[model samples]
Target: MTSNFRHVALIGKYQASSAGSTGDSSRQALEDIAHFLERQGCEVALEAETASNAGLTHDYPSLNVDEIGARCDLGLVVGGDGTMLGIGRRLARFGTPLIGINQGRLGFITDIPFDTYQATLSPMLKGAYEEDLRPLMHATVVRDERIVFEALAMNDVVVNRGATSGMVELRVEVGGRLVANQRADGLIIASPTGSTAYSLSAGGPMLHPSIPGWVLVPIAPHTLSNRPIVLSDATEVAVEVVSGRDVSANFDMQSLASLLHGDRILVKRSEHCVRFLHPQGWNYFATLRKKLRWNEGGS
Candidate 1:
């Protein structure tokens, strides 16, 4: 059957190929997936970085992120959640749909198992799938009344103290109102989709993906009274560097910028959202059960 998506972009986890054998495997996997996509009557292209890092020399066209966003109807990401997160943020603006094939340990977002991808993906390409829209957050660093740096985060925005530094003091605000003055090793502002990530690890609540909210969690606060809080997504959040040395802000753990005293990291809901295509009958709870071992002892 012809694919519902006529043009597809193949993206692999090239970072896993630090070893020679791993590189070969990554290259082979990309080639294999490309052939599979072609058999489904879809034109395939390799993402430029994936082709370069994996040393792919196939006759298929190699395209950059912008090119893929402009031309491809579907993006088939063959990697772990990190790979998906990276490409997801870049492609969100273009509104391209993505499907993930798991090659990493935790397949939270990359739900499809690699070994059985063929059986699962075939039908999905033909429009037999579930679609999910995940929102993104826009974060910016403002210094001296000017925006110094900015980026979009699909997961969380983190402000952390340097490894050698002591606790950092942060002044938090929500919707232009004073929230609290927190002293901690760091602070995490996570979207609902990121609740299971760094936020959960830092003692924040697990927010369902459908929730229109954000979680603010402190990392090892100096005062025991400082705790995690969930806020409405419509509200804007700002965390100012009150006192800290060698502090930095991370967007989705991908982009980073150093923060100085009085520097404010502003965060708000982004206009763009990522589109994920899951196999029919896919469930969020089912994914949590499998990935988090929630049903380990159940029948």
Candidate 2:
């Protein structure tokens, strides 16, 4: 038990992928979670879309993302990591802490399972949980020294070619020093929290979440000599589109911005960090072992 959370908000994925079509299980889980929190003597609010998806009655209150951020003591995300990503990025600016209840595949960031909700959510609501602060990246695309596009990404910021089967060149600089002139499909600048995401799939090393560094992984580089590099959190990275080809800068593989020649995308650590509340006995390594099947030893 750490901090008492009195006001809790609920958010989840809109679509469910089970049982042909009814999606009764997923919808019931949301209703039960809401009622459970209310019974625990905590005020609960649901995000507008989540309320709509769950078919909540008019008696239940609903708040938009901004309202939830401004008021709720904690937010409970009731879906997969993607749902958390969307909510976390939005709430990060308000410094709101979030807890995730797994209802989708992978559930990497959504640590709690639907089956364990009865046992986990109650104790966790009573202040039995671990709080983890994860740093996010604030990325901006600057064309001619003026900011053109900006967004926050909880995972990795990707600069890749768009809609064509060809390689693009990117000139990478960190803290004003040239790091590489990469000829590749793209470059992924990922926070440590994103190490196991797109970066890992592109052959980047897995970074522990506590690491105060960012990884730069080149995607399908023309030369094998070009490899992934980790930079200190303090370092400011700038990537220029040197190949004169149109490239896209992606935030958490969601929001996108198009880049042309002379466009430079800047990536740096965000001032605000997202806080995750995990249930007691939640182990990161154990989660990795289960999700990734590390112990099965099948290379």
Candidate 3:
């Protein structure tokens, strides 16, 4: 209940105007938040890119991610989950707490809506909020036993067919043990926070944030015998291309890299975690019920 925050950083989409929400109109909503923070005697700095996108005047200070992470107590994201994902990956390494204001559709992680952001903003400024520490995944692609592409994902890492319409063959292993030889469109390795994302659309189960596990989902598996499985987050997963065809590896549905024959992808829980600050009264189940429209029917 101690509001020790002093410096705050504001980050938004490069083109906030692309969003239909008023929040993005000349970055008006972000300006409003900055004013509110200033009123609290907090030093506000905008992310350099976001400031440039908004055409911010020289009156306000703009800093890069590294500077903001080094100086700021909280980083505020004023766009959708996609924006949060990108910023989260960078800021998480600095251990800076992040708060999101949803300005896009289906903002599962960006919980605060533009309309009610002010109401929620007050408590957060006073250090009255909940914190959720989420895990990240480290992925590396190996060719001929040499490491090639590598990146981190806050959501899921997928090994998918590149251009061909046909399913691909993959050999999946857990902790150096053979798990399955899967023939499918692709394979998804998702963290608990990602269970509600691509994995969910692939018929994977929803995992609570408290679950210390990761999910393996086969996308459009050729056989009905293939089912989604949840394993300990500590488990390391290795996916090898059994077929001679090339495939694509995607991280968080953003970063992409091509994988050739004999290529292997190694995925494991990352030592770093992203910390999200939620307004008081925020409920994970409630958010899920609303987002998934689970309120429609129940047992």
Top candidate when judged by lDDT against the true structure: 1
Q: Compose the digit string of candidate 1's lDDT tens values, residues 65-152.
A: 9999999999999989999999999999999999999875658799998899999998898889999999999999999999999999
Model 3: per-residue Cα lDDT over 1-299, one tens digit each: 23458899999886555345543574786788898888877888999988877767474899999998899999999888889999999888899999999865547899988888878888888978999999899999999888999999999999999675588999999999999999999999999889999999999998998899999999999998999999998989999988836688999998998888789999998888999999888888878877877864553
Off by over 4 Å in 2: 1-3, 15-23, 296-299
Clashes of each: 0, 0, 0
Looking at model 2, residue 55 earns an lDDT score of 71
TM-score, structure 2 vs. true: 0.93
Stronger candidate by TM-score (1 vs 2): 1
TM-score of each: 0.97, 0.93, 0.94
Cα lDDT tens digits, model 2, 245-268, are 668899998799999888999999
Runs of candidate 1 with Cα error greater than 4 angstroms are 16-19, 296-299
lDDT of 3: 0.88
- Candidate 2 lDDT: 0.86
Residue 243 C-alpha lDDT in model 3: 81
Instruction: Name the weakest run of 10 consecutive residues (lDDT summed) in model 2.
Output: 14-23
The residue-level lDDT of candidate 1 at 54 comes to 82
In model 2, residue pairs whose N, Cα or C atoms come closer than 3 Å (at least 3 residues apart or on different chains), thus clashing, are none
